[model samples]
Structures are given as C-alpha cells and as structure tokens.
Target: MDDKKPLKRHEALKPLSRQHHFGLLFSWKLRKGFAGNISVNRLKAYADWFFVHEIEPHFKLEEDHIFPILGVRDALIVRALKEHRRIERLFHDQDNPKNSLSLLEEELEAHIRFEERVLFAEIQKVATQQELKKIEEIHFEIGSKEEYMDTFWEKN
Candidate 1:
C-alpha cells in the first residue's frame, strides 16, 4: 500500500478546483487542435474567448479572495500571480498566435498544476475557518458556470 498522504481539498476551494478542471480541459482541447492541424486563428479565437470568460474572472477571484490568505509576499502567491500575467500575455499575443497558443497550452497546464498541487494545498492548510467561509461565499456569488458557443474540441 502506498503511504503517501492524499491531499484533501476543502469545501471552500472546490469552485476553484472545478475551474482548474475546466482550465485543464482548455489545455487538452488546444493540444487536440494542434495535433489535428486546426487553424491557429481558430485556436487563438477560442483561447481569447476562454481567457475572457474563464481565466480573467478566475484570476480575479484568486487574487482578490484566495491569495490574500497566503499573503502577496508569499513565494507561492508571487509565483502564481506571475504565472497569471504570463498566461494572460500568451492568450493576448495576436502577432504570433501560433507560437503563443502552443506556449499558452503548456504554460496554462503548468499553472493549473502548480495551483492544484502546491499553492492551494498550502492555502487550505493555513486558512482559518472564517476565511474559508468567506472564500466560499464570494465564489458562489461569482457563479463560475461557463457556456462557450463553440465546442471546437469535439471530435469531428
């Protein structure tokens, strides 16, 4: 039997975790688009949509609600915020979109992985019950449902 401890995600952060799942799906869809020789413009357009609909709000929630739990100076929070800026840049880079999309696919996946595996675990470990409750409140109020029109990731 493996003895490694399974990380327990708290109820407060569940919404963010679910968002991370969508982020991973976004990355996977981009990979599929790349593999299938889907047009870079199509992929970039979808990326832009996802950035506005999903990533921007998600980042705001984390920065405003969650990161303060760990403090801005905390190395993990600093790294996460930097990753957010980089990911945003990748999504917005229209001049060299093909390369940018490729980098976005990789970097976005890595950013999600970092949050899921490291930063969030630390946040949950240190956050007070009151803080967690507040996080849950804001998260629910934000309503994280995504409804993008194009299901470009679907196998044609």
Candidate 2:
C-alpha cells in the first residue's frame, strides 16, 4: 500500500516535472515498441534523437541550475551525476543497442522518478526563494518542446 503525501512541487520545478512526464512517456513508448516488435535500429534511431535533443539538454539544465541547490558533494547530487553518466553511456552504446535501449528505457524512467520524488524534494526544502526564482528563470520554456518527426513510438 502507498501512503506517501504528494509534494507540492515548487514553481521552479514544474517545468522539469513536465519534462519528466514526457520522459515517462518515452519509456512507455519503448515498451510499446518492444511489444510491437519494432526494429531495434528504428528504436535506437529514436533513442539517439531523444538523447541528443531532450536528455542531454535536460541533464545539463539540472546540473547547471537545479542540483547546485544541493551542492555537488551531496550524496543525492552524486547519485544523480553517476546516473547521468551511466545513462549517457547507455544512450551511446551502438554496438549492442538492443540491450542498451532496454536498459535505457528502465534507467531513464527510474532517474526521472528519483529526481522528482527524492532529490527535488530535498532541494525544495533547502532552496532559497531567490534560488528558486533563478531556477525558474533559467528553465522557463514550457510548452516549447521540439517534437521528433518520426512516429515510431506511435506505430508501436
């Protein structure tokens, strides 16, 4: 049974949370693709596109603007950075993309969940009003996602 009270995400974090929603959707699409028997090459192409466009920029945004609230030495930040590197490696593994994408699907979703539920909660607890405002200002481009033309996820 689940009894956790939902954290009311700070305004500064809402944009990232929106992006996390898409990240979860991305994972669901991967599962759909696998179930639909979509070709690994096709899935890898989409994963490559997403990693280049969304994941890279997203990671940079957190590392630059958000994670600093908790400092680089914080255990949560350390774990997040390690996850980021591991996810980057998973995204770039071309020789064994089938296994890699499968891992990526799981890894990315889990990473987003950890940030949303744990790290962000901790940050919000400690972040100053000015710090939150700074974060919001830096990452305030809501509803401006660049959509990929390939609809392999939909096909699957």
Q: Highest TM-score among the candidates is held by which one?
A: 2
lDDT of 2 by residue, 40-140 (tens): 98888888888877788888888888888899999999999999999999999978999999999999999999999999999999999999988877844
lDDT of 1 at 114: 96
Clashes of each: 0, 0
Which portions of model 2 show Cα errors greater than 4 Å?
1-3, 142-144
lDDT of 1: 0.88
Candidate 1 lDDT tens digits, 41-95: 7898888888878889889999988999999999999999999999999988978
User: What's the TM-score of each model vs. the native?
Assistant: 0.91, 0.92
lDDT of each: 0.88, 0.88
Candidate 2 displacement at residue 40 in angstroms: 0.5
Candidate 1 wrongly placed segments (more than 4 Å): 1-6, 140-146
